[model samples]
Target: MKRLIGAGLAVVLVPVLLLSMLVAVLFGSEDEAQAAPPGGQPGVVCTTAPASGSGGSAGSTTGQDVAGFSGDQLDNAAVIVGQGKALGVPERGWVVAVATAMQESTLRTLNYGDTMANGQMSSSRGLFQQLDAWGPLADRLDPAKSAAMFYTGGQAGQPGLLDIPGWEQLPVTVAAQRVQQSETPDAYAKWEQPANQVVGAVEGRTCTTTPAAGAAGGTSISLPSNPRAETVINRALSQLGVTYSWGGGDANGPTLGIHDGGVADAHGDYAKVGFDCSGLALYAYAGIGVAVPHQTQAIWAAFPHLTDRTTLQPGDLLLYSSNGAANGIHHVGIYLGDDRMVEAPQSGDVVKISSGIWGGNRGAEFIGAVRPGA
Candidate 1:
């Protein structure tokens, strides 16, 4: 009788003790909870902006104007900005988030998509038109939860701005695409100006600034002792935000872009007015008193080829080609030492610092490096 009583007591006591400890561990102290980051709550803290005028108009009280949106739309935009602030995204990120929401759902917390043939709504919903892949319907419909998910991605493995390398320096549209992966990647660009305006209106500050040049990932390449190489790198860096065009730049400078009549034309890149890959390289080399051709194959032919990548020096042209043949070279970029290179990547893109010369869609046949004037 005594043994059975002791066993029963032990069973009840052990569980009770375990439960007490678990509760303490989970809750922690009041100070610890307070110290936790925002968004730790079940939902983000949302505050309605003060209305303007005697009529209590929905426009911002901060004196900046947010026209064209109703009270509900402005409120949803505020939520996105709030979530972005909670997540520690920069001011530029706030602009991006608001712009993305503006484009995706026009700041509406949608509950359904266009009706399908079966009379059911499409899977996409919420302020971002997020599909079921983003999260559960309840979470998606909650403006705060959806905004957090958009900024940090979600329980699923969808890409977000935090996941993208050098997202800060990327064009607004490109950064948004890194997360959204929309069918029409360039569509987001149109929303950038309005987004900046809305963010400025909500935050009560100017927000028309572009991302600062050389503000992306830190400079990977160490400056070489060669003066000419330094000039080439600096020249390339000067054109950081210039948009990519099929046949845009030259030895003189950036020229008005001409239509490629190819995939580039489909993106409305004919009027972009910037540099192509080889054209950028041509302009950079020209800055150093070296005249290089505006064609990749011709540029490769103009210089002595370095058979080994280890022998490559700053200002060398890193050439990529479909095949490892002389005539096969199609893309050219100025190497900036280390693994970094400066190139104007594709139409509807821009001149930017790429971490590696050959990767992704650019096949691995590195036709080798060309040292101009070596």
Candidate 2:
């Protein structure tokens, strides 16, 4: 929910060329009977490891297909929902929590710190992207603990889900907003439909539903389906833990960092060896004999897009905007599957795996993903 805010912040809104993508089997038939939530009935650690069914659960960890999420992604949601249930955050809070997670980290566990638009490093992390003031990094990253923190309160005793005044009366998005107070007040609304779909999925039930009329979608993306995607992802992952030196990478390897004269200079990135966001991407695709440039937008424009952006696969590049504007694509990352990505997040940071999605900052939404190369 937080990220670097550099200067030169000119933003232009574009039509939200949003794409709604979900695996249909993840949301069963309308007649499918409702089953209890994961954990076999809403207890602590209500997590499930996916059954080794051959046909395709899309790496689902809950043993059942869940829309837009699988593996640890779905597990994170179960933790959120189950924790909310344990705390008795009202059934509404469960949906609100799921929706909120959808808004914050796309139900993935984010480990990277973000810098705000004002160019300040924000130590926000975890499923909900709680700030450093929330708790320790470990606590923030723990699904159950983070969910508990969201339900219980922040370190400053800020209200959690149940503490909000008249929270139950609020609509799903409204209830989520009360807890999040995000800059994008209405962003959570888009996920409301999917959130219910997720809760129903976890509970072993689903309802007949229709898309909310006028529902805006986020930028769509796809992970690598390219035959050489493995080479790209492995190349990127190989550089994990390298410092995020601005302008400091190439198709060959890490190079002397360059100074951006701002945050990059402040971080002494010029003296370091590493890769910036686009540089890392450039280096990654190079492993596949792709010579994309080191600029995020340039790389974005270098390749033709895949026909579909529905399923996020490993090695797809996720884009970000400082102001949530579609035209403000400022950053990029290599998707690493299971709602995780490897990125060189900011000047003082390191290239590492983060909970794969950005909720946008200063008002924009995460441009979803469409794989750039065929």
TM-score between candidate 2 and the true structure = 0.41
lDDT (C-alpha) at residue 187 in model 2: 57
lDDT of 2 by residue, 93-130 (tens): 67778777776777778776566678866688888888
Question: For candidate 1, what's the RMSD?
Answer: 21.7
Clash pairs, candidate 1, are none
lDDT of each: 0.61, 0.59
lDDT, candidate 1, equals 0.61
Which candidate gets the maximum lDDT versus the true structure? 1
For model 2, how many clashes?
A: 14
Give the 10-residue window scoring lowest on summed lDDT in candidate 2.
35-44
* Location of the lowest summed lDDT over 10 successive residues in candidate 1: 13-22
lDDT of 2: 0.59
